[model samples]
Every structure is written in C-alpha cells, then in structure tokens.
Target: MRATLIYGAGDVRVEEVPDPELREPTDAIVRVVRSCVCGSDLWPYASRPATSEGGRIGHEFLGVVEEVGSEVSGLAAGDLVVAPFVWADNTCDFCSEGLQTSCRHGGGWGQDGVDGGQGEAVRVPQASGTLVKLPVGEDSELLPSLLTLSDVFPTGHHCAVTAGVDERTSVTVIGDGAVGLCAVLAAKRLGAERIVLMGRHAARTDLGREFGATDVVPERGEEGIAQVRDLTGGDGTHRVLECVGTKPALEMALGVIREGGAVSRVGVPQYEEGPMGVAEMFFRNITLTGGVAPARAYIEELLPDVLEGEVRPGRVFDRTVGLDEVPIGYREMADREALKVLVEP
Candidate 1:
C-alpha cells in the first residue's frame, strides 16, 4: 500500500506503507477510491518545520469497505461508503446534538496511528458512526460530488446554516476556494436571494456565479468592503461567510457585515486574534459563530441532492491526480494552478 506523508514545508511524498488492520472493534478498513487536497492542507505545506520522519496526511475519502471489525455491524466487506474528516461515535451526546466534530469518542484522521485518506486504504474508527453507506456504485459518475460530503460541502453548509441564511438574507462570502464556492451553493440551496462573493480570481468567481453569487468583488481591504457594501445598498449584507482564515479576511468580514448581521467562519483560523473582539461585534450587536463542521452529521442530508444532480459541489475539483502525483497536486494547489485536486488512489 502507498500513502501520503509530509516531511515538512513543501515536502510531500507518497511511499509504500504498511497496510492497515482493524485495531479496535469499532474499526473498519476502507480502500480509498476518491480523495482530494484541502485548502487547509496548505498551512502545513507552507509552514511546517522540516523533519526527516514525515507524518500521515489527508482527511477526506470514500471507498469500498475491505474489512470490518467483529463488533462493527451494519457494514460488510463490499459496502461503498464515505468517511468524514473526523471519526466520531455517532452515539455520543455531542453527536446526538448534531455536533459530530466534537464527539466525545472521536478524533481526526492521520493521527493516533490511523491511516490518512490520501492513500490506498484507511482504517476508519467508529465505523458504524463514521462511514456513511453510498447508494452509488464504485464507478458512479457522482463519485466526485459524493466525495465532497466528507468535508468541503458540509463545511460550507455549516457556514450558511450557522449564519441563518434564508430567502430574505443577503450574504457576502469571503474567499473563492472550494469551501467558499460551496458556501455560495449552500446559501443558494437555502434560499439566499443576494449572494456576494469576494474573490480576486476570475475563474473561481465565475463558478461562484454559477453557484448563485449575485455579485463578485475582486478587490481587497477597504476597497473590497466598499464594493460589497455598495452591492447591498450600503447595508453590507444580512450575513457574511468568512471562508478565509486570515486576519485580513476576518477584518473584511467584520467590515462588510451589516450592523446586526452574523458572521459564520468555517475556515481554520490562521490568526489567534482579530478585529471582531469588542468594537466590531459587541457594539454592533453582531454574532460570531462557526467551527469545524460536523460533516458526518450532514452527509445524509446532503447526499440526496448530489445524487439528483441538484448541486454539483464537486466542480470545485479542477484537477485530478494518481496516488503518485499527489506531491505535484499539492504544488498545483499551492501555486493556485488548480482549484482543488481529486486524488484517485
């Protein structure tokens, strides 16, 4: 078997690794069919210190079940399933409350001796709670779209859901990455009438329009904020989805939101503090929310739409790579040469 490893900054390698085995009764082994590079993966690619001993990487994938633990029920060796970025026991209190990301018994991929999703196979913990069966076969054309359920799509939906988007709401989504574009689609699906996408790239913003963005602001800082405000009749917007986890994006989010609007950020924050502390959020009566999306909780609800071709969030994947091409895939994403890269391992 071959899996991806990060030796450090700009160092990505795919090498032969030990095949995964069931380590717990709640575990199952999935032979990965489709996976992809996430924007968040770039943080480590850019800043992680150099190391000779690399660690496992990647977190989103779907595949056929190759094995299941004795205690893992409702699954078999041939079931097609998708694994969310986190493995959570759906029976936990947090999971019951629809916060699978915080499940008491759950953890992330590529840690704790678990295999990464960007590989030939992965050992999924809490198998019954984590892996959702797919109605489509291994060869379905919907594989790419269905794969987004593992992370990006659900994350975008969480951003919209947390912001309370509806037909009456006008939204401004920051960033044109996969998650940002998906946020636009999610907002549209939830009936947001006016969608303003803040992105500098024309190609990505073009897809944002297809996903239902009514306006695109390609500027940055004050100029971008002004453009968004102008689009919303000088009122900013009812909600703002901050998909870029940087100080500037946060500042732009607070800057372009209506006084009473809420800002939901699903992007992994790169900064510890920002402009939303007291002056912006407190005095303006604005709400700040959003965290790691409980993607496991959203798969079932979003699956039907993907199956019916109502939403094609997979369009965000503009490139594809084999297991061996993952390093190049990372470079392409880092260089902005690819929107997202689908790894077919």
Candidate 2:
C-alpha cells in the first residue's frame, strides 16, 4: 500500500507503506476509495521542520470496508463508509454529549502508527463508532459531496449552530477557503436571511454567493469591518462566523460584531495572540465560541441534504488527483492553485 508522508516544509510524497490489519476488536480496515487534501494540512506543509523520517498526513476519506475485527458490528466487508477526521468511540460520555473530539478513547489519524486517510487503506480504531455507513454505491456521482460530511461541511455547520444563526439573524462569514464557503452553505441551510461573505477571490466568492452569501466584502481590517457594518445599517450583524483563524480575521470579526452578537470560529487557529482581552470582549458583551468540529456528531444531520442534492458542498473540491499525484496536489493547494484536492486511490 502507498500513503502520503510529509518530509518537511512544502515536501509531500506518496511512498509504499505497510498494509493495515485489524489490531483491536473494535477496529476495521477500510479500503480508501476517495480522500482529499485539507486546508489545515497546509500548516504543517509550510512550517514543519525538514526531517529524514516523514510522518503520515491527510485526514478526510470515504471507503469500502475490507475487514472488521471480531468485535466490530453494524459494518461488514463491501459496505461503503465515510470516516470523520477524528476516530472516537461514539459510546463515550463526551461523544454522547456531541463532542466526539473529546471522546475518552478517541484519536486522530496520521499519528502514532495510525494510517492516515490519504492512502490505499486505513486501520480504523473504534470501528463501529467511527465509521458511518453510506447508502450510495461506489460509483455515485454524489461521492464528492458525500465526502464533505467527513469534515468541511460539518465544521461549517458547527460555526453556524454555535453562533445561533437563524432566519432572524444576520451573518458575516470571514475567509473564502473551502471551510468558509461551506460556512456560507451551512448558514443558508439554517435559514439565515442575510449572509455577508468576506473574501477577495472572485472565483471563490462567486461560489460563496451560490452557497447563500447575500453580500461580498473584498476588503480587510477596518475596511472589511466597515463593509459588514454598512450592510447591517451600521449596527453590524447578529452573528459573525470567523472561518479564517488568523489574528487579523479575529480582529475583523470583533470589529464587525454588534455589541451583543456572537462569533463562532471554525478555522484552525494559526496564531497564538489576538484582541480578546477584557477591553475587547468584556466591554462589548461579545460571545466567543467554536473549536475543532466533532464531525462524527454532525454527519447524520448533514447526510440527507447531500444525498438530496439540495446543497453541493463538494464544489469546494476544484482539483482531483490519483494517489501517485498527491505530491502535486499538495503543491497546488499550497500555491492557491486549487481550492481543495480530491484523491482517488
């Protein structure tokens, strides 16, 4: 089997690796049929120190079950399934609370000997709790959209839900990355009447509009803040979905949020410091929320919409590559040549 490994900054390679086998009674081996590059993967691709021993990378995929441990249930050979970005025992208390990311026995892929999603196959721990069986066949054209349920779409939904977006609330989504675009789609699905998308890329913002952004703010800093405020009659929106995890993006969200409004950030934080001190948050009574999305919890909630073709979150994938071309796919994503890259193993 071959899997993607990161050697250092901007260096990604697909090399032969050991094939996975069930090592736990709750485990399953999935033959990866579709996988993709994630925006968060670029952080390590750009800053990881160069080293001789590369580590496995990638965290989104859908596949067919090849084998399951004796204890595994509700799944069997040939069943099509999708894996959330993180693996968890859905029966755990944290998972039962809809916070699978904090499951007592949960973990992530591409670490500590666990096979990453961007590979020929993966060894899934807590199989029955981690893998969701898909109704579609291997050849369904909906595969691309269905894949979003693993991470991106659910993340966007988290942002909207956390911020209390509703038909009565106005929304301003920061950033136009895949996750940001999905945030727009999620806001619409939740019945947000007005969605303001902040981004400069014409191609992406255009899709943002299709996804439900009623206004596009292509500026940054105070300028962007003013644009969002202007759209809301200078009062700012009721909710701000900060989909870009940069200090500047956080500042913009703070600046554009109304006095009592809330901000939900779904983007993986790229910086350590921001304006969230007493003067920034306390004075305004602003609510700050959002973290790593428990995609496992939201998959079922978003699956039916994907299957019905009501929303096309898969539009985020602008490029597709084979397992052999994964290196190229990473480069394309890092260089902004691709919005997202889908890998077909």
Candidate 3:
C-alpha cells in the first residue's frame, strides 16, 4: 500500500507503507476510493521542521468497507461510507449531545498509531460511530459531493449555524476558500436573505455567487470595511462568518459586523494574538463563537440535499490527481492554482 507522507516544509511524497488491519473490535478497514488535501494541511507543509521519518498525512476521505471488526454492526464489506475527520465513539455523552468532536473517547487522524486518510486503506476506529453509510454505489456521480460531507460542507454549515444566520439576517462571509464558499451555500440553505462574500479571486468568488452570495467585496482592511458597510446601508451586516483563521481575516470579520451582530469562525486559528479582547467585543456587543465542526452530527442532516442535487459542494474541487501525484496537488492548492484538489486512489 502507498500513502502520503510529509518529510518537511514544501515536501510531500507518496511512498509504499504497511497495510492496515483491524486492531479493535470497534474498528473497520476501509479501502479508500476518494481522498483530498485540505487547506489546513498546508500549514504544516509550509512550516513544519524537516524530518527523516515522515508520518502519514491527510484526514479527509471516503471509501468502501473491506472488513469490519467483530463488534461492528449495521455495516459490512462493500458498504460505501464517509469518515468524519475526527473519530469518536457515538455512545459518549458529548456525541449524544451532537458534539462528537469533543467526545470522551474521540481523536483525530495521524495520532495514537492510526493511519491518516490519504492512502489505499485505513483502519477506522469506532467504525459504527464514525462511518456514515451512503446508499449510492461506487460509480455514483455524487461521489465528490458525498465526500464533502466528510468535512468541508459540515464545517461551513457549522460557521453559519453558530453565527445565528436566519431568513431575516444579512450575512457577510470572510475568505473565499473552499470552506468559505461552502459557508455561502450553507447560509442560503438556511434561508439567509442577503450574503456578502469577501474574496479577492474572481474565479472563486464567481463560484461563491453561484452558491448564493448576493455581493462580493474584493477589498481588505479599512477599504473592505467601508465597502461592506456601504453594501449593508452603512449599518453593516447582522451576522458575519469568519472562514479564514489569520489575524487580518479575524479583524476584517470584526470590523464588518454590526454592533449587535455575531461572528462565527470555523477556520483553524493560526495566530496567537490579534484584536480579540474583552473590551473590543464588549463595547461592540458582538458575539464570538465556533470551533472544530461536529461533522458526524451534520452528515445525516446534509446527505439528502447532496443526493437530491440541490447542493453541489463537490464543485469546489477544481483539480484532480492520483495517489502518486499528491505532492503536485498540494503545490497547486498552496500556490492558489487550485481551489481544491481531489485524490482518486
């Protein structure tokens, strides 16, 4: 078997690795059919110190069940399924409350001896709890969109839901990355009447409009703030979705939100310091929320829409590559040459 490994900054390689097998009664071995590089993966690819021993790299994937452990039930060989980025036992209190990301027995990929998702096969812990079966076949045209349910789509939905977006709320989404664009889609699905998407790229923003953004702000800093205010009749939007984790993006989100509005951030925070402070939010009467999305909790809710072709989140994948060409995929996305990269193994 071959899997992606990161040796250091700007270095990603697909090399032969040992095959995975079930080590726990709750585990299942999945034969990966589709996988992709996430924007978050770029952080490590750009800054992690070099190492001679590279570890398995990747966390978003969907596949067919090749085998299931003795304790695993309601799933079997040949079942097509999607694995959320985080693995958890669905029986936990947090999972029951729809917060699987914080499950007592949950963890993410590339940790605790678990192989990452970008490979030929992966050992899925707590298979019954972590894997969502798809009724469609392997050759279904909806594979790309179905794969989005594993992470990005639900993450974007989390941003919108946390921001308190509703039919009467006017919203502004910061960042035009895949997640940002998906936020636009999610906002529309939730009945937001007005959506302002902040993005500089024409190509990506165009897709954002298709996903239901009523306006696109291509400026930054004070200029961007002025533009958003102007678009919202000088009052600013009632809700803002922060999809970029950088300090500047966070600042922009704070700046364009109305005095009584909220900002929901789903982007993985990268900076340690920023304008976020008690006085800043207190004076503005703004609400700040959002964190790692509980993807498993939203998959079932969002699946029917994807299957009905009402939302095509898969269109975010502007490039495709084979397992061996993953390095190139990473470079393309890192260089802004692609919005998203899909891997067919």
Best by lDDT: 1
lDDT string for model 1 (140-231, tens) is 99999999999999999999999999999999999999999999999999999899999999999999999999999999999999999888
- lDDT (Cα atoms) of all candidates against the true structure: 0.95, 0.94, 0.93
TM-score for each candidate, following the candidate numbering? 0.99, 0.99, 0.98
Candidate 1 colliding pairs:
none
Once superposed on the true structure, which residue ranges of model 3 sit more than 4 Å away at CA? none
The lDDT, on a scale of 0 to 1, for candidate 2 is 0.94
Count of backbone collisions in candidate 3: 0
In model 2, the worst 10-residue window by lDDT is: 271-280
Off by over 4 Å in 1: none
Residue pairs that clash (backbone atoms under 3 angstroms), model 2: none
Model 2 — TM-score against the truth? 0.99
What is candidate 2's lDDT per residue for 1-345, written digit by digit as tens?
A: 999999999989999999998899999999999999999999999899999999999899999999999999999999999999999999989999999999999999999889999999999999999999999899999999999988999999999999999999999999999999999999999999899999999999999999999999999999888888888889898899999898889999999998889999998888887777887789889999999999999999899999999999999999999999999999999999999999999
- Residue 235, candidate 2: C-alpha displacement in angstroms: 1.3
